[model samples]
Target: MKIKIISSHKILYQENIISIIAPGYHGYFQILKNHTPFISILKNGCLKLESKNVKKKIKIEGGLLQVKKNLIVIIL
Candidate 1:
């Protein structure tokens, strides 16, 4: 799966990720390969990603996330 995070100033992160955990407005949620298409409003929290046995995280103030066809794009 592919993930991309962008802010008004620049692209924060972009990579082929295995899984993701995001801070949704209601709660936390996760995404993996071949998952259903989704869209959510994020709250202030960390965005976690895992790929190739490595995990990474980014702090987000708030954002929007959209997923479709194994691609995810986050705007903050």
Candidate 2:
């Protein structure tokens, strides 16, 4: 799956990832490749992204998340 994390100022990150863990309104959740479409309000927490060879963690204040057709977009 591909993901793009955007902020008010610029695009924070973009990459092809195997999985991502996000802080949703209720709690933390993980999204994997080919997962069903999803949308949610994000809370202040850590966002984790994993790829073939790299793993990253980003701290976000709050944001919105949308998943569709193997694409994930995070607006912060």
lDDT per residue (tens digit) for residues 3-75 in model 2? 9999889998999999999999999999998989999999999999999999999999989999999999999
Question: RMSDs, each prediction?
Answer: 0.8, 0.6
Tens digits of per-residue lDDT for model 1, 1-76: 9999999999988999999999999999999999899999999999999999789988989999999999999999
Give all candidates' CA lDDT scores: 0.95, 0.96
Stretches > 4 Å off in candidate 2: none
RMSD of 2: 0.6
Give the candidate number with the greatest TM-score. 2
**lDDT (C-alpha) at residue 64 in model 2:** 99
TM-score of 2: 0.97
For lDDT, the strongest prediction is 2
Model 2 has an lDDT value of 0.96
